[model samples]
Target: MLSALLHVTLPLALCVLLTRCRLFDAVAVDLSYDHYAEQRVEHLPAFLAMPCNCLVNLLYIITGVYWLLRGTDNAEPEQGRYLRQVFAFMSIFYAPVQWTRLAVLQRAPAVLDQWVTLPIFAWVLVWIGFIERGAAGWRVWHAAVLELLSVLSYGLALLHERGFEVALGCHVLLAVYKGVRVQLTHGDARTLRNFMFAVLSCCGFVVLKLLDLPLARYRIFQRFTGHFWSKVCDVTQIHFSICFLTNMTSRTKKTR
Candidate 1:
């Protein structure tokens, strides 16, 4: 977390500044309300125009707060607490980014919605490293460099319309790889199950969002949309990630 004030804000601010400079001008983002399947209420406030999309963000904030307040053993090292808190803050901050994207349908928020996502997935790998190799395994500079690269990796979006998706795919794969590896080596049945659910939720988040338009033809998807359900899965993914990582951290504490 680096308390999220310095280490986290640095990369995120760099992302905002870089994208503002027109470096992310070519990034492909849907800046239209019609991009979603939910019908908008023009009379309502902009943030609440699409009821489902706007309200679903609350789940993220709720989940974040729950984890942030989650109790920890006094024996737990600062590293474990840092991992959990950083992730909780990420969930809390990310929902607003998505909400702003839906509310304004502007490129900045839209670009932000896509750009910030890469590091969230990358953080899973960072956490896995800590679980496997202990605190010394993941130094401050190591995380800073990883997060910086994760944020900077959005430059790929300028290369092609699908560049962001490519970067996201790689992040997802690496996280999955590291998750599986750590679970096999260090996890018990409970953590393994949590990891599986996290991975599945992540897959649902990606696939459902991708199928947002195509799935709208289905009746259930018309009102609730794949995009909306994807947010649900994203929040679920975060919850299970907290469960899995915290459990692993607890296991590490006991072993020490």
Candidate 2:
């Protein structure tokens, strides 16, 4: 219990506290819209989108490590090995982008930001494909296609000056579709519960993030609600995603 508290709950609390620290705020990326020519504004604490995204990604890494160390060995050794690689690669590819955006290249152009984030979503789609289709059904071609669509979606958002609104909407819809499909196909109570939890977390994440702009302006919302709730939801979404995927994989292995 103590180990779980220290490793699991402690990290989450620390990350939430870290988000409010003025030091991180000092290093946050300038989020002013290039199209609008608005003066550079202070980054929002609720913008747990990428800068501090590594915090949640750390949870993913820990979860992956736990599975790799303790998960039951499957008959398909190669598949297990490959899944480990995918998890490691995703964590490696994701962390650098967050660090770069937050600290290394603080003033980097938004286009660069978009390019780095492209892989993040592509990896997500691939992970979901792995859950739904198994190793045999998971294909690079599908991930490539989804990556292309993500690029186009972001491109359109940039041109229209909405700044990833449309792209995020599309990704959320895609995630929901994937989760629903997995539940329908698997027909497991635990998987269904995880899916429902993820859906709720995703909904909260989207709503809080979208409202961050308007709500975070007010002192009360910024200090007490908007930023805090957004971070909580964002982290919850990631945690539950890891839980869902890991649970699904465990079920698959057990059934086999």
Candidate lDDT (C-alpha), each: 0.86, 0.53
Model 1 residue pairs with clashes: none
Per-residue lDDT tens digits for candidate 2, residues 33-149, read 321111222564423333333244454455445544554445433544454445444443334444444433334333444443444445456666766667677775676576566
How badly does each model clash, as a count of residue pairs? 0, 0
- Scored by lDDT, model 2 comes in at 0.53
Candidate 1 on 23-76: residue-level lDDT in tens? 667778888888888888889999999999899999999999998888888756
Note each model's CA RMSD in angstroms.
1.6, 10.3
Q: How much does candidate 1 score in TM-score?
A: 0.94
Model 2: residues with Cα > 4 Å off, grouped in runs: 1-96, 99-118, 213-221, 253-256
The lowest-lDDT stretch of 10 consecutive residues in candidate 1 is 1-10
Candidates in order, TM-scores: namely 0.94, 0.61
The model with the greatest TM-score is: 1
Q: How accurate is candidate 1 locally (lDDT)?
A: 0.86
